[model samples]
Target: MQALAGFLWWAAVFLSPVVREATLGNLDPVAVAVFDIPLFVVASAVAAFGVKAAALVSAGWTGAVAVALAIYATVTTEAGWGVLGMGAATAGSLIALCLVLLGRVPTAWIIRGPFAFRPAIPRPTAASHVASTFGQIVLFWGFFLAAIPFAVAFLEGRWAVVLLFPSFAAPVGVAVLILASALGISAAVAMSTLGNGTPLPSAMPNHLVIAGPYRWIRNPMAAAGILQGAAVGVILQSWLVVAYAVVGSLVWNYVVRPLEEADLEERFGEEFRQYRDAVRCWVPRGSKTLRSQKP
Candidate 1:
């Protein structure tokens, strides 16, 4: 039911401007933009209460902004220039907003004009502790640095090279997929955190996660990374990026995450083992759920 509402809300965002244009025949994009902002503000506030809600809100806001921008462009100026600006902003914003919703993916917020840290809580189980802390430091921090070029290439200029990837498509498709995957990942992270972390959603990461996406697959977050990364690669068409995706995914799975998981197991002991047994490391092989495990 929640997913359905989210999809409908998202669909409305993309379809609204078109509907307005079709019905009204002509309208100002600025007016559309003005109307759209409130929708996002309301959605964001509502999403604050829960993870699925947050994912839906993020998608709603993103679709609203993009479509509004498109309408604004079509009505005010030539579609080409307006599209370029909107496209750039949407791509950048998708990554930013999506990352923010994935609670496990760390990000900072500005409070009083200064950046305030809001990191993910460390896992208390042996499963989470194995990743070399240094590896995480490098990958996440590396993401920060990588974000610059990604934004620059995606928005500021057309790096002719981006035309090659399979997943890369037209601007509209790319935007939609990015937003969708972000919400999906946000949902996965929410499940992981709630199931494995503290009982209170906002409390902290308290244990290793091996349910939901973890049941079907080991690293849903990494899958999201690949999706978003591919979106960027498609947008930029940089061979380096394509290569980066291949190398990065392998390393994250084989080299980095296992360490984190091992540490988690060591920390939590038999409790972690019971969770692991009930849940597949990365494959959801059976109908059973870990809901009946020993606490």
Candidate 2:
């Protein structure tokens, strides 16, 4: 996938001249051919050889190029097709960068050091957990749902893009939001009351929480959060916001979940392993079956 992303990025740059000519009228393509073409080709080639250093460099360079093109399209270009082209290029570059980094870097390196998951010593009280959960809700809803979406909308407006939801989508989004909120609240309550902790890693529950929503799914909070984010995007009808929510979920799943689970296994040993093996991470299973196999 990393190699494919690199090639796709190279291909996008290689065809920049034609894309620009078609969308923005006649433009000098010499600069791209002379500079970008050779640079990307060599970077992609070296990265394909499984060279970690080369992959890192390629990822950085491609990301920088993507940002530059996005800025140019948003600020300098008036053509819609040109903006779309730039968007595609930016997506390609970002995909390439993510793939390269994930493929090359060790999981331990990514999750350890400053990024390590360290649970709080001396479990927090019920009052403290309640306060922490409330704070988290405010931060997540205010920044991620409201502020970031507003920013994305502002940027999209610069390209003369208008996003709107269908009448039905608003109701559906509301339904999803309500359900997700309920699930998240339930999970938080379980963590606090039963597990004796907050949702934050720094104040994680000391005990394994297999009650309430955990009886069905391994990560009810995460699922609810991701669902809430997507519901907000649906309500707002912003593709960028939806993509942001999806990307955030992917990051949490691939990067954070493993470390979290590792910590759980280390602490709870066979108890956690049995629960994990029985329950699905995102999906809920039949209640009877889950209850029957309760670890």
Q: What's the distance in Å from true for residue 157, model 1?
A: 9.9
Runs in model 2 lying further than 4 Å from the true structure: 1-18, 21-27, 50-57, 77-103, 109-115, 160-165, 287-295
- Give the per-residue Cα lDDT of candidate 2 at 222: 91
- TM-score, structure 1 vs. true: 0.39
Q: Deviation in angstroms for 183 in model 1?
A: 5.1
Residues 1-295, candidate 1, lDDT per residue (tens digit)?
Answer: 3333334544554578753343223545456546444444444444445546554555656566566655554444423233443344444445445555665433222111322212246565523423333244346535732674375454323322233545535474469446746644553454434444431223223545554455555556566665566556555655545446666677667655665556556766897777666755444567766553123
What's the lDDT for all of these models?
A: 0.48, 0.69
lDDT (10s digit) by residue, model 2, range 158-264: 65455676779878988999999899988888877667677877677777888889989899999998888888888777766777789989988997898899899
CA lDDT of 190 in candidate 2?
Answer: 80
Error of 2 at 67 (Å): 2.1
Provide TM-scores for the models: 0.39, 0.78
**Cα RMSDs, all models:** 18.4, 4.4
